[model samples]
Target: MKKERAKVEEVSTTEEKYAQWKSQVPVLYDWFANHNLVWPSLSCRWGPQIEQAVYKNKHRLYLSEQTDGSLPNTLIVANCEVVKSRVAAAEHIEHFNEEARSPFVKKYKTILHPGEVNRIRELPQNSKIVATHTDSPDVLIWDIEAQPNRHAVLGASVSRPDLILTGHQDNAEFALAMCPTEPFVLSGGKDKSVVLWSIQDHISISAAADQGSTKSPGSGSSSVKQDSKVGGDSTTMSPSIGPRGIYQGHRNTVEDVQFCPTSVQEFCSVGDDSCLILWDARVGFNPVIKVEKAHDADIHCVDWNHHDENLILTGSADNSVHMFDRRNLTSGGAGSPIHKFKGHSDAVLCVQWCPDKSSVFGSAAEDGLLNIWDHEKAWKAKERIGTRTRSTSPGLFFQHGGHRGKVIEFHWNPSDPWTIISVSDDCDTIGGGGTLQIWRMNDMIYRPKEEVLAELEQFKSHLNTCK
Candidate 1:
C-alpha cells in the first residue's frame, strides 16, 4: 500500500512538470507539433525530402509499431509537412491538442514486418533503400518505393524484403549503421562481433534502370551467397546473402555501431562491456584502436561527426555523454575522453552531432529530457573565471522537456536546420502508446545576440514610421 502511494505521487509530479513545460511552448519554440500514436515505436528516422514550398516542405518519415501480440508488428512510412521557420504564428503553435493527430503528418504506406523493428537506417546513397534490425541474426533491406503497401490487420502476410544480409550468430536487434560513402551495411549482435557487408553491386544495377530496381541487391555478387526462400509462398520469401567480414573483440553484446564519415573502410562500435573499438577493414578484421573502459556503464549509442572527422560522441547508461578526439585517443592513452557533459539524470540513450554545426550535439535520456550542448562553451566558461560571468551547466544551452516519459529515439532533420523529430514511450504516463513531437527552437535563442538585436532595432524603426 505504501509503494502504491509512492507511485501515484511520482505520476502526479510528472504531470505537474509536463503542464509547466507545455505552458511555455509558445515562448520557447518557433514551431511545434504533437501527434499521439496508437502503438509505441522503438525507432524513428527522417526519409528523403519530397518537395519544397514557400511556407512548408514535405518529407518522408520512417517509424515502427511494436504491437502487443494480438497483431503482427509493422514498418510504417509517413509523409510529414514541415513548416518553414518563422512561418507559424504563436497562437497556432500553442493551441495543439495533445490527444489529436497532427494534420501535418499522414501515413503513406505500411509493411508487415517479420518482427518488431528495433532500428531503421536509410542508405546515404539511396534514401529509399533502408536497413532494419529485428529479432533475428540478419539485417533486412527494403525499397520503400517499390514495395506494395499492405493494410496492417490481423492474419496479414508479412512483407518480403528486397534483400537480406545474414551474418550474426545471435540476434542483431539493435546495433546497425549504413556507410555514408558507399553502399555498405554494418551490424553488431549478441554474438559479440561486428559484421560488415557490401551492397555495391545491388546499387549499381538499380542505377542503370529507370524505375526502381526489382533485382535482388546481392543476386550476382561473388562475395555474397544468395539463397532462395522455399516455403508455402516462395514469392513472398526474400533472398538472403552472407556477410563479407566479421570482427570480434567485445566480451558482451554490442549496443551500437557507426561509420567514419569519409571512409567506408573505417568504423566504430560500442558495447555493454564499456569499450569503444575502431576498425579499419583494409587492415584486416582486427580493431585498429580499442578504448577500454570508455564509460562507467554500458554505452548505448555513438555518432561520428560528419563535419569533423577527429571528433566522436558517445552516450552511456551512466547518465553522461563523452566527447573524444580520435587523434588524442591513442596519444592520451586509454579512457581519456576530451570532455564529459554530465547533464542527464538517467540513462542516456541517444547522442548525435548536429549536421550543421561541428561542435554542437544533442543527447536524449530515460530521464525525459533532451539536452543540446555546444562543447566550445566549456572553453569559454574557463576564459571568464574571474569575471562576473557564472556558469551552472557550461555546455548545455537548451533543454527539451516536452516528453512525459523516456525518449526512446530522436533524429535531427538534415533537410531543416535546427529542427528535430523525437518519440517517447508514454503509455504509463499519458495513457497512450507513445508521443511523437517535431519542433524547432526560436531563432532568437540560438542566433548571435548582436545579429538578433540589430534585426529587432530595424523592425522597431519600421513600426514607428508606420505609426
Candidate 2:
C-alpha cells in the first residue's frame, strides 16, 4: 500500500509540474499576439543580448549572444516549431533545461577566446557547419554534430570542433560569408582587407581527426600556412591557416560581404568608404566593377537579388536604400542608383532581398521599423499594383514596428516566404536585454486593414499593462 502511495505521489508531482508549465504558455503567447509582436514562444534563458539570428531551415534557428563583452559567447540552436507553438513549448523548454534534450535544440559556449563573436553564418550548402568570426583575427568553423558531448552536464556525448582558419591581421573581422556553390569562405576586416579561405583541405583534416587517424602537418593546429597566393595582392602569406587569396580595395571598414547568389565566382563588399565593389573569385580580389560613392554615408549592408543577378541593393547610414544595376556602370565614374527608397527616419542598417520574390525586399532601420518595398510598382508609377494616391507613401508597401530599440539585423526564412526574424539591441524597459521578433508577411499585408488596426490597438494596450 505504501509503495502504491509513493508511486501516486510521484505521478502527481510530474503532472503538477507539467500543468504549471502549460498554463504559463498561453499567457506569454497572448502577450505577444495581443501586441502583434509575433515573437517565438520559446524564450532563451540567456538575457536578450542576441547579436545575430539565422534560420537553418523552417525547423531550426541559430542565435549568437555576447555576454559582458567577453570571450566564450553562447551559441543557441532552437527548434522553430517548438518555439512558435504554444502546445508543447513549455515542455520543450523544460526538456532543454533538463538537458535530456530534443533533437533540434542545443546550446554551447564557443571555445574560441579572442573576443566577442562579430558574426555567425551557417554554410549555404551544409547547415551542419557554422562559421563564426570574432574580434580576434581567426574565423572558427564548428560542426554542430561534432559536439555530441557539448551538454556534458546532461551526460551527452562529447564532440570537438572540426577546424579553425586564422591569419587575418586586421584588428577585427566584422563580416563573413560562404559561397553557395564553392567550398570557399570570405572574411572582411577592419584593416581594409578581405580574404578568401578554402575549406577543401580543412574538410579532409577534420574527417581524419574524427576517425582518430594520424595528424597531418598542421592538422588540428589553430593555424596553417597559405599554400599559394592569388591576385598579385600585397597581403603576405605564411603556410599557416591563412587565406587562400587576399583582396585589398576597401578604404574603410568592410561592414558586410555577400557572395552573388547566382554566380560562385562573383561576390560583393560594402564598406564605411561608401564604395560597393564586386569581385571575381577567379581573378583574385581586384574589383571587376566598383561603384564609388554608392551611398552618401557608410554603407552598412548589401544583398543581391536572387532572381535578377545584375540587381544589387544597399542600405546606409544616410537613412536611405539604393538599388544599382551592374550592367549599366560606366568606367571611372560613379553609377547613379536606379531607384532610391526614402522612408526610414534614421540609419537603414540592413537590407535583404526576398529569396522567392524577385520584386520584393525588406529593410530594417535604426528607426525601429522594418519596411517592405516592392519595385514592381515603383519601377514605373504607371505599373503600380495597388492604388497610389498623390498622398500615398512612395515605394513603401508595409511598415512593421514591434521592436522598442533599433532593429539591427533581420532575415527572411528561405523556406517560408511569409516569415521573417529580426534582432534588436535593446528594449524599452530598463535592464531588459535585447529582443528577437518574428513577423509574418500575411499578417502584415494580406490581412484586412481593419483587422491589422485592431491588433495594433490591442498591442498598445498590452504595452500599457506591462508598464
Candidate 3:
C-alpha cells in the first residue's frame, strides 16, 4: 500500500513538472510540432527531402506502428512539412493539443511488415530504400517508393521485401545500420555476431531497371525463395541474400551497431555484454580492437562521429555516455573514456552525433529527457571563474523535457539545421498512445552570448529610433 502511494506521488509530481515545461515551450523552442500517435513507435527516422519552398520543405519521415495483434504491424512512410527557421509563430508552435495530430505531418503510405519493426535505417545512397529489423533472423529491405501501399488490417498480407538479408542464426531484432559511404548493411543479433552485406548489386540492378532494362533483377548474389502460405499471387516470398561476412566478438545480445561515416570497411557494435567491438572488414572477420567493460551495464546504443573518425560515443544502461578516442583504446580493461557524461536518470536508449556539428551530440533515455551535450564545453568550463559551487553535468547545454514517458528514439534532421524529431512511448504515463515531437532549440540559448548581446543591442537601438 505504501509503494502504491509512492507511485501516485511520483505521477503527480511528474504531471506538475510537465505542466511547467509546457508553459515554457514558446520561449525554449524556436519551433515545435506535436503529433499524437495512434500506437507506440519504437523507432523513427528522417528520410530524404521531397520538396522545398520559400517557407517550408516537405520530407519523407519513417516510423513504425507496433500494434496489439488485432491489426498488423506496419512501417509508416509519412510526409512531414518542416517549417523553415523563424517562419512559425511562437504562439502557433506552442498551442498544440496532446490528443490531436499536427497539420505539418501526413501519412503518405503504409507497408504491412511481417513482424513488429524494432528499428528502421535508410540507405544514405538512396533514402527511399530502407532496411528494417524485426523479430526474425533476417533483415527486410523495402523500396518505400515502389512498394504497393496497403491497409494494415487484421489478416492482411505482408508487403513483399525488395531484398532480404539473411545471416544471423538467431533473432536480429534491434541493432541495424546502413553505410554512409557505400551500399553496405550492418546488423548484430542474439547470435553474438555482427553481420555485413553489400546491396551494391541490388542497387545496380535497380538503377539499370530504372534506365529500362529488359531483364529482371537476379543472378548477382546467391538467392533463395520459399513459400509459406502455399496459396496464390498474394502469397509473395521475397528474394533473400546471404551476408558477405559475419564477425563474432560480443558475448551477449548486440544492441546497436554503427558504421564509420567515412568508410564502409570500418564499423562498431555495442552489446548487452558491455563490450564495444570495432571491426575493419579489410583486416579480417576478427574485431580490429575490442574494448572490454565499455560500460557498467548493457550498452544500448553507439554512434561513430562523422567529422572525426577517432571519436566514438556509447550510451549504456549504466545511465551514462562515454566518449572514447579510438587511437588510445586497448583491449581487456575498463576501456579508457576521455569523458563520461552523467545526465540521464535512467538507461540511455539512443545517441546520435549532430549532422551539422562534430562536437555536438544528443542522448535520449528512459528518464524522459533528451540531453544535448557539447563535449568542448567540458574543457572550456575549467577556464571560467566561479561558475559553480558543486559538480554538475559538464557539456550539457540543453535538456529537452517534452515527453512524459521514455524517449524511444530521435533523429537529427540533416537538411534542417538544429531541428530534431523525437518520439516517446507514453501509453502508461500520459494515458495516450505515444508522442512525436519536432522541435528546435531557440537560437538565443546556444548562440555565443556576445553575438546575441550585439543583436539585442541593435534591436534596442531600432526600437529607440521608432519611439
TM-scores of the models, in the order given: 0.92, 0.68, 0.94
TM-score of 1: 0.92
Per-residue lDDT value at 1 in model 2: 100
What's the CA error at residue 178 for candidate 2, in Å? Answer: 1.5
Cα lDDT tens digits, model 3, 1-467, are 99889878877977887889999999999889999999999999999999999999998999999988889888999999998888888888888998899999999999988888999999998999999998888888899999998998767777788888888899999999999988899999999999998888665655766798743443245465553421113557677767778998889999999999888889999999999999998888998889888899999999999999999999999999999999887644335888888999999999999988889999999989999999998657645634564467878999999898899999999889999999999876877588899999998888889999999999999999999
What lDDT, from 0 to 1, does candidate 2 have?
Answer: 0.63
Compose the digit string of candidate 1's lDDT tens values, residues 118-223: 9999998899999999988878899999999998878766888888887788998899999999898999999999999887755554564547645554343322
lDDT, candidate 2, at 202: 65
Off by over 4 Å in 2: 1-58, 69-72, 82-114, 148-161, 204-240, 382-392, 427-430, 443-467
Cα RMSD for candidate 1? 3.7
Clashes of each: 0, 13, 0
Candidate 2 weakest ten by summed lDDT:
33-42
Question: Any runs in candidate 3 off by more than 4 Å, and if so which?
Answer: 203-220, 227-234, 331-334, 382-391
lDDT of 2 at 410: 76
Question: What do the candidate models score in CA lDDT, each in turn?
Answer: 0.87, 0.63, 0.88
Overall local distance difference test of candidate 1: 0.87
Q: Best candidate, TM-score-wise? A: 3
